[model samples]
Target chain A: MKKLTTPLKVEDLKDLKAGDNVTITGYIYTARDAAHKRLVELLEEGKELPIDLEGAIIYYVGPTPAREGEPIGSAGPTTSYRMDSYTPQLLDQGLLGMIGKGKRSQEVKDKIVEKGAVYFAAIGGAAALIKKAIKSAEIVAYEDLGAEAIRKIYVEDFPVTVVNDAHGNDLYQSGRKEYLQWLKEN
Target chain B: MRQIDAGLITESVKKMVMEANYFLPEDVYSTIKEAQDKEEWQLASDILDKILQNADIAKNDQVPMCQDTGMAVVFVEMGQEVSIVNGYIEDAINQGIREGYEEGYLRKSVVGDPLNRVNTKDNTPGIIHYSIVPGDKLKITVAPKGFGSENMSRLKMLKPAEGLEGVKDFVLETVELAGPNPCPPIVVGVGIGGTMEKAAFLAKKSLMRSFDSYNENPFYADLEKELLEKINELGIGPQGFGGKTTALRVFIEYYPTHIAGLPVAVNIQCHAARHKEVVL
Candidate 1:
């Protein structure tokens, strides 16, 4: 398993491979459909973004309501593909990593290769399980958006698997192909 | 007719919300465990492990299973002989949802306007369906419908002559087209019959039944088994990584329909499958 820390760099993304387990630490940023829209709007306006994109990892999520005595509610990853349209734009601005469930679009994969970015797949539907990695979390911006608001999360050993590598390797494609072929033969 | 207090209905709903959102129903938990044991792929097994862990954390910590805690959805069965006092049953359910969501610190996922995209803020005004049955008690079940799987759900209106093969093909294609997106190893709910909307409603409602539960009709049960086998054959696997356990279960609910049309709705559910029930 790989350990990730904050202030991530392009070189930090180089060695990662599809299917490799990873434990991510440091300050991860949050985004979902609404947040993605706002981020794109900010980019279009040539304005500073809510968070820096350089060597940063964005988590696609919107958490549940927090009960008493908790930092956040079941905060599992949303599907990554929903943010496909806005990803390349952010990757162009130096976004190096993303964490969510499932696959990315071809265009997103191409950009990941060209920009040396990586996509990590977190366990979908495993919100509470994944949230345990988040030792501390606070809304950093966009509070009015509720769960979609951007939050800066301090994680410890946040487990994930590399789904799309900088080299454009996609596990979803390879993995599905392997099983489907086996199904046909048997 | 008997009178029932609105406050009681509200309390029942609140319990339903908390229980459904925070806990994994025992049947679902066991079903996942069974699937994990049966899953041959290491990656899929590990994913299933993490899902079990997620349910643990959500239950023990009183956290929601997913951050999207989903739009509050409830199915209610009321006895015709019984009557609610001081308020309409629908409004009481809305009130319960509001309180449960607020009290639980669950995300308010509902929006007031689809076009303007404004959040209702309290998660009130749940999508509630009620059926009047013979009994004195009101039975309700709450299922938090997440956007990921809900987005992938499909409804098709085919000519009656299309037959069973058409139904099976459509379902397989829906999941195939969904690919990795709906967080696979999904539970597919098939609603066949009635009008288009009824088919969709039954599909969602069928999901409320136990994952391991078989259709009462033997023929339908056989179809369920066959469908499950075929879906696993697709190799969509866990989270769409290749594997044998593409689906944990298939539940089909059908009603007699007009001779002209056969409507089938496929409602896909991720592994979370969080649901809870209360009767009073």
Candidate 2:
């Protein structure tokens, strides 16, 4: 396992490989389909974004509202493919990483390699356990969108596996291939 | 004839909604636990561990197991001998969802219109299926369905001649195409036979069955077992990391259909398979 602090630099991701477990600490932004649309639209309009994209990791999540005395409720990654269309533009804007579940389009994977970016996978249904790593969360944009609003969250030791790294390797592809090979041999 | 209060139904549904969201059903929890114990792959085992821990945290802390909280899907078995008083059952049920979402702090994930795409803000108007039975008591089952798996569901209308092989192929193909998106290890609910809509409905309904239960008919029960084996073979594994635990269970629910058509539907459900019920 490796440890990483956010606002990642290009070199910070240079050595990470697919299937490597890592724990991330620092601020990550939350956005899903609705917020991603607005962010891309803002970029198209040449308007400033509410949060900086430079060296920042985005988590594809829409956490439940926090209860009294809790930081956030059931925070976990949503499916990542829905954000594939908007991702290349974000990468161009210096978005360095994403944390979510599932596969990415080949175009997005190629873009990740081109932009020196990383895509991390958090266990999809493990929301309550993942919430423990979230120290604090506050809405950063599009509050009217409710759960789909963009929120900036501070996390400590948030566990994730490198799914797609800067080298263009995809864990979802390799892991299954390796397992199938092992099954055949054994 | 027996009379039942609609308000009582509302209260029960409200409680059921909260309970379903907060607690992982025992059948699902235990099956996951078993999967973890038997899993050989390190990564898959760890993923299963976290899922089990998440359930524990949700139950103890009284928080939702997943952030999606899901749009509530209710199944009603109304007793023919009972008359509901004070209000219509549908209104009562919607009222329950309204109050439960607010009080429980669950996310409101429903959209009022498909095209306009405005959040209903209350998660009202759940997809409800009602059936009339001969009993004097009302039975309600609250199943909160998260969209991750629901979006991956598929329905097919096959020619009668295509038969059993066609059904197996479609189910496998759906799971394969879904890949890691639906949060495997998933529960696959299959509905074979009936009309198109009925097949789809049956598939969704099969998801409500306990994981430990199999179809009553030996032929279908055997097919369910066979399908489960083939699905795990796809190596989707837990969270699609690849392993032997791709699916915890596969359920088949069937009804007689037109001789000309053989309809099949597959409803993929995430590991957080949550449902709770009450008799009134």
Top candidate by TM-score: 2
Candidate 2 residue-wise lDDT, A67-160, digit = tens: 9998888888999999999999999999999999999999999999999999999999889899999999988899999999999999999999
- lDDT per residue as tens, model 2, B1-280: 8999999999999999999999999989999999999999888998899999999999999999999899999999999999999999999999999899989999999999998889999999898999999989999999999999999999999998889999999999999999999999999999998899999999999999988799999999999999999998998788888888999999999999997999999999999999999999
lDDT of 1 at B101: 87
DockQ, model 2, C-alpha based: 0.87
* C-alpha lDDT of all candidate models, in order: 0.86, 0.94
lDDT of 1 at A36: 92
lDDT of 2 at B244: 88
User: Please, what is the TM-score per model?
Assistant: 0.96, 0.99
Worst 10 residues of 2 chain B by lDDT: B235-244
User: Interface root mean square deviation for model 2, in Å?
Assistant: 0.7
In model 2, where do residues sit more than 4 Å from their true spots? Answer: none
